[model samples]
Structure formats: C-alpha cells, structure tokens
Target: MENENLLKQISFIKEIDKIKYIQRRTKLFNSDRNENDAEHSWHLAMMAIVLAEHANEPVDVLKVLKMVLIHDIVEIDAGDTFIYDTAKDHSNTDEELIAAKRIFGMLPKEQAEEFIAIWEEFEEGKTNEAKFARSMDRFEPLLQNTSNKGGTWAELNVDYQRVYDKKKVINEGSTSIWNYSENLLNECVDKGILKK
Candidate 1:
C-alpha cells in the first residue's frame, strides 16, 4: 500500500558514519581531513541562524534551517559532488531530483511532499528563503579554509579569484552577507590566511 511504503521510508535513515561520505577532496581548508554531509548540513543550518541578520532581506531562519538540514538528503542517494571537479559537468540538481523521489517517497505522503518541496526550493535557489539558506551554505567552506590556514586552498593552488568564483552565490542572495564575506576573505588574504 502507498501508506505502508511511506511509513517504511520515514524510518529508514541513511547512515552517515561511513568515512567515504561527504569527503570532498578540497585543498581549501584542512589537509587529509574531509567533512561529512550531515555535519556540513548541521553547520550550515547553525550558520543560517547566527548570520540571519546579514540577509539582504529578512527571512524565516527556521525555514532556512529546515531547508539546509534536508537539502542534502538526496546526496545520500546521488552522492556528493566536488565543487572544483571539471568532470562533474552535470549539475547536482539532476541527480538530486531522482534522489528526492526515492528518498522522500519513502516517508508518509504528506511529510514526504513537504520535505521534497523544501529540497526543491533549495535546489532552485529562487525564493528568498532558498537564497538566504544558500548564502550560509556557500559561506561555511570559505570560513573553514580561512580559519584553518587555507590548507585546502594551498593544496588546490587556489587563488583569490577562485574563491570569489565559488562564493558568488552569497552575494546573489544577500549583498549584506556578501559584503561581510568579502571583507572577511580580504582580511584573510591580507593576513595570508587564504592564498592570493
């Protein structure tokens, strides 16, 4: 029955303990250390809360948190993609769409749809909520790189321009936050925290 399938899905949580999960081969932050998707999602949700004031327009932080927490569940099915991989030509959106149907479809009807909608909103990045949520999403890794001595950047041979290219999403959704981020990155550059 449809109801039966939904119930089963709700109870099935993908395991996040596997070391291979969310192990982005980044040269921007720490060396030989990889971040898990669950941790990244949780951290981004928290960053959304702490940095809500920097949004270009006021937004519902709770909604953003929900979006962040659930956004990458599909990654469990489709796998995480590295940011700088030239071969990763297909957008994560395509993979996640299939993943969403399978993952959220497991939950009960109403809840599944609600969660799927949130995930889709995040993928589209069209709404104020999605935009606000995404700014936090993009900012966290930059912070990780700068605070951790830009080990990731150093390994990747990253330049300031590459950093800006990767972080443009922050500016698109929230100029205030973007300004703050720019200032931070600039400081990091000045202090030799991020490679120029």
Candidate 2:
C-alpha cells in the first residue's frame, strides 16, 4: 500500500504538469508573453511569503501558500477563466469541484482529503488565510496589468469601476495592498491604458 501510494503521488505530480500549459489572460511583468497557471501559482506563493506582513489579520504563510498552489489546479481540467469576462456566465463552480476531486484524488486517500480541504477552504475564502490568498490572486493580475501597460484590462476594454469591483477583495486581506492597488488603478486610468 505504501508503494502504491508513492506511485499515486508520483502520478499526481506528473498530472499537474498540465497546469503549466493552462495559459492565463494576464501577461508577465515587463513582458508580452502570457503567464501560465504554474507561474501564477509560484508567484502567489512568493507573494504570500513576502506580503504576509501586509495582511490585515495575522495569517499562516504556509497555509496561504498551499491555498494559492492548489487553488488553480482545477483549472487544468476546467480551463482558465478570464477575470473581466463579464459576459461569460459564472457557471464553472460545479466543473471546478469535479476537477478538484479527480485531480486531488490521485493521491492517497488521506493526502487527497487534506488537499481537497485546502482547495475547498480557498474556494470558500472566509478564513484569514483564504482571504489573504484570494487577495494575492486578485493583486497579482493587477500588477501584471499595470506592468504590461494595462494588460488584459486594456485589451478587453474593462472600465475602472469594473476593475475596482473585481479587486475590492484585496481590502479583506490587506489594507496596505488594497491602497497600493487603488493607486495603481488611478495611474492606469490617468495613463489612458485602462478605460475610465
């Protein structure tokens, strides 16, 4: 059973490599290349570690890292969802849950349960860790948009109010980050990169 579990774990690790192929709408900092789920996850983990000091409430850095790492693994199956695609119906919740089970289930039962619990906690976004993790999710793309001279927002014609609505979750995690994001948004508007 132990060897079988090891094999299962190996298979799961290999399976998640598909995440690298799942390209996001966000661009890399100072680059035109689109970012992938793997890079996004890694960036979020780093952000959790570096920005934990800015969180409004105390957070478990490891827990935040874990949440960001696995949060998008489901996208390997459900595909990447663009944040500003308001016309796209918000209907992927069920699909993502199914994907989460199939992907995380590749591990031993106990390990799968733990991963699923963390993923679910992220989806719920209520705990301090989850809130902070979600903040990173929103904040990273904002940085990407700012860095790339208005990235997806400019390309998609997303307006300032919509951007604010989408990113207000940052306030729940870190007041400092939210303030910084607000200033960035204003700069984007002034630069005429983001729609006003």
lDDT of each residue in 78-108, candidate 1, tens digit only: 7777676557853456777898887777777
Per-candidate TM-score against the hidden true structure? 0.83, 0.96
**Per-candidate local distance difference test:** 0.76, 0.91
Candidate 2 Cα errors over 4 Å, as ranges: 89-92
Question: Which number leads on TM-score?
Answer: 2
lDDT of candidate 2 over 1-196, digit per residue (tens): 9999999999999999999999998899989999999999999999999999999999988889899998999998899878777666443488898998999999999999999999999888899999999999999999988999888887888899999999999999999999999999998989989887
Best by lDDT: 2
Pull out the clashing pairs in model 2.
none
Residue 1, candidate 1: C-alpha displacement in angstroms:
11
Q: What's the TM for model 2?
A: 0.96
The TM-score between candidate 1 and the true structure equals: 0.83
